[model samples]
Target chain A: MDKYILGKYVPLNTFIHRLDPRMKILSMILLMVAIFMPFPSWTFTFVMSGFNALIIFVLMLISKVRLRDIIIQLRSIWFLLLVLMIINIFLPPNGSIHIIAQSGNFKLYAESFMQTGKVMLRLIEMFGVAMILTATTSPQELTFGFGWFIKPLKKIKFPVEEVSMTVSIALRFIPTLIEETNRIYKAQSSRGVDFKHGNLKMKFKGLIALIIPLFVSAFTMSDDLAFALEARGYNPKAERTSYRVLKWSTKDTIWIILITLFAAGIITISAMHLDLLRHFFPKIW
Target chain B: MQIEFKNLYFNYNNNSEFKVTVLKNINYLINKNNITAIVGKTGSGKSTLTELINYFLKPTSGQVITDGFISENSTKLKFKVVNKLRKKIGYLFQFSENQLFEDTVIKDVSFGVKNFYPKDDGYEQKSKEALRLVGLDESFDSRSPFDLSGGEKKRVAIAGVIAYKPDLLILDEPTAGLDAQGKKEIMDLFKKIHETGVQIILITHDMNVVLEYADEMIVLDNGSIQKYGSPKEILKENVEKYNLETPHIYKTINALKEKGIVLNNVTDIPSLVTELKKHG
Candidate 1:
């Protein structure tokens, strides 16, 4: 459970931490867009992955958050990465030729293997960027940044404040829900629900034992929290003033410039007619 | 089952640099069939102590010796054996009402019984009997646990444990948040449960509950055992020292004794009033 480090902000007095969260959020979106900007070739994918990793390493150094902690946070998603790799492994290349057994059509192309690695690397890069954003930004700042970004939508009568409040509450309750689920699971285990044992059917039964209680308690907690919020004069429509404002610093300006340049570079690369940037599905024989 | 702690130390977030030691060098023997009440202020390791009983928490340094097993770290125990051990000890968590999950009261109570003894034919009857033991009759069995009052929900949660019929029953602040009558009813139910030869360990701040029901008392201060003795002796000697409020009867009795009245030490209100009558 400690491995599941979602949105756990690490307080540090480093350059990355000091950057405005709005800039951080904008940079994260830009980086994500660049990462998902489909690579034209396997070589480009590998090159982009290396570039992403290098950028993440630099961010880690500037943030002063331990690389070990980031790795631990990444461990929770390793299974998903493995599954993606496994799925890619069995798929035949676009123009596959017979490698070992032509009768069974079992063709193994070197390009396909590289393609699998490329996809896995892309996923890792995405997760790495997400982890950085969550680790660097506190929940309040993250939500505030989100609200600020979406502030333009309020012109269309979009109820942006209510939307941001919902998102913030949902984000805040994720860890709380996880904790509550853990408690209910333990309580059920104490009552002889052998969650660690039994076949698949029995395990599902054990899960019900946990889920029912978790829902009941979650509802109760939400009720209490709603009351507390109302008591504190928290109205969604109210013009709320915050204690700490996100100031735009020089570091934010520099980071924003770098991300904008990176985005421009991605678009420029996509427009170029380089052979290395073209998709290549080599035939295997 | 006999429980013993030898030089126990417990720390939270044990692997982190910011780890904090919550309990230190705790050593005590909790004998079977006796009601032992653990009293401490908030954050004084009372809940942590109860967690140790069911092996929910492992000691940071020393051993928790229970029955035929000794555990310092939770990972050392075999998974199946841990479940079996847990089945034999009922734990009523603080604010136990939150543990109720089943749609109906009967299902909630039967949950533990069915889990521990999947093949048992008399689970429904036994669950109903457990509910009855907690003073909820069959008429309320079909009702949703969610619709019940706070005290009723707590009772159903307790019945969920009682249905399992564990040899050792550990309750954490069982009477908390209950009205006066509700508190008394729950305490009387606990006394009745103890009378059935089940060992009871209670973690509470209510000195009155401790004085009236507990045969032995353990006072905790800053995660260390400050005092352990008979309730009468511990309250008389170390109540002020431990920064605990004296029960009303004990306060009056002590006030009279301070004036050289020398009335007999009594735990309950009726007996203390009778002693005062004798003095008159």
Candidate 2:
């Protein structure tokens, strides 16, 4: 289940893999809105994970990638951020920077392990800038960068090219539904359906016998990919004209002026609540 | 039963950097209660050599032995020894009538006889005697294998892999997209489940269903094994230089052995119409 390395791509050509897929989808939606516009500020999460670790080390050295393939795509969502930081570091809250413990009636806090280690470092910097904008954009340049961000909302007529062809066929079927759920979980685990040592009611009946043949082979491959996108003449209100235009150079205006001066230096250092960068990232709170 | 495949090299991303090599440097030796077949054409590697006998793809390097169970790679076979060697290998799969998800045809032929005989006790009379051995009896058990048809959903997916009895079945293109009477009624219910001795293998491009039910053929192209033998000595030579295509009753018995008229064991079309009625 090599979990389709999340939105795959990886063809590597460098320089954030030649940017401007609408400036890497508007610098990954302004770096996931400046990593969830800070609120719990432990010196605003160590200066926003040290400016997202220098933008994940210059987008993994300009998309040559490999920091163990972005820690194997952020270790597939680290088991829901390690069960939400182990239920917020063993159930916190009644604070005063706690942990002056008494033994039996626990207490711990330290502001819930510095607020779940600053929400797991803002979820590993929003899953490493969405896996470096899907390993440097290519699914038809991320469907022409979400059809150039919904082409000016098609002048209010909307249906913006059928919502960018249903978001590029749901991001090209997330690696064809992870290779048809890894071939219907290797054809129902070659019909024995053990699915990794059962028992949770036989692993929920081997996950509904591998999700009813992965929803009957994903509704029989989306009805043969909707009759092969209606036998090719796919007219989502026609007039579609793109071969691969997107140019806007000057290195996409210096990546929109360094993501608008790093979102105005993270909203002016979270509105000046910088007690000297809280005496240098005072263990994140 | 005997499967072997020693220096077998199958590679599909052997730790990436675009690996691919799908079964090159391979070798053979199938021998165990007959049948074989395996022709080629569509990206050769005949369904990656029937998923390396039943590891469902492993050999990115070597070994696969089988009926003495060796394995060697594909993570040295575990998961209860590949579900007890997939309950003795019943494979099927290439449009195995879309691996039916069950909802009937007697719970999809007792879903692999209750996943490899879970405490037996006549698993509903062995899933209605494997749906009456693929002809589909017991009034099509409680219908709805998506309401049958395309050759009764490939005989309820070959009675759900021979109702888990498998002594080695490996099918693949079991009469793909049928219709010459659904490919002679699923090759006469796989020649009555290979006369109950089981050991089948099949995988075809249909050199007339490997000259009417192969007793060993192989062929494969790019990823190696160009000819392994005995479909009347690999369809009697110049089989279009191994791209294949001889079976039109082996080009009318090689145009009546180029007029000299020798028909020694004519392979099919009713054994070349009973050897041209002994030369009329």
Top candidate when judged by DockQ against the true structure: 1
Q: Write the per-residue lDDT of candidate 1 for residues B145-246, one digit (tens) a residue.
A: 989999888989999998989999888888888888988999999999999989999988899899889999999999999999898887876486677878
lDDT (CA) per prediction: 0.81, 0.77
> Which stretches of model 2 miss by more than 4 angstroms?
A2-9, A15-41, A57-110, A122-188, A196-285, B1-40, B44-119, B122-170, B173-190, B194-202, B205-209, B214-243, B255-280
- Cα error, residue A80 of model 2, in Å, equals 7.5
Instruction: Count the clashes in each prediction.
Output: 0, 0
- Which residue segments of model 1 deviate by more than 4 Å? A37-44, A64-83, A93-105, A227-235, A262-285, B238-243, B257-264
Candidate 2 whole-model C-alpha lDDT, 0 to 1: 0.77
What's the DockQ for every one of the candidates?
Answer: 0.60, 0.17
lDDT of 1 by residue, A1-285 (tens): 566665577766666777788998889888888776656556566776788778877876776555676567557767876776566557755654435434355555566566667766666667677878887888888999989999999999999989888888888898789878777776777888777768998789888888877888778789999999999988788887777787997777887999899877876775674435344434420
Candidate 2, residue A22: the lDDT equals 81
TM-score of chain A of 2: 0.37
Residue B123 accuracy (lDDT) in model 2? 81
Predicted candidate 2 versus true structure: per-residue lDDT over B59-144, tens digit per residue: 87788788877775746556887788888888878776766776887887787778777788788888788888777777789878
Q: Output the number of the TM-score-best candidate.
A: 1
Best by lDDT: 1
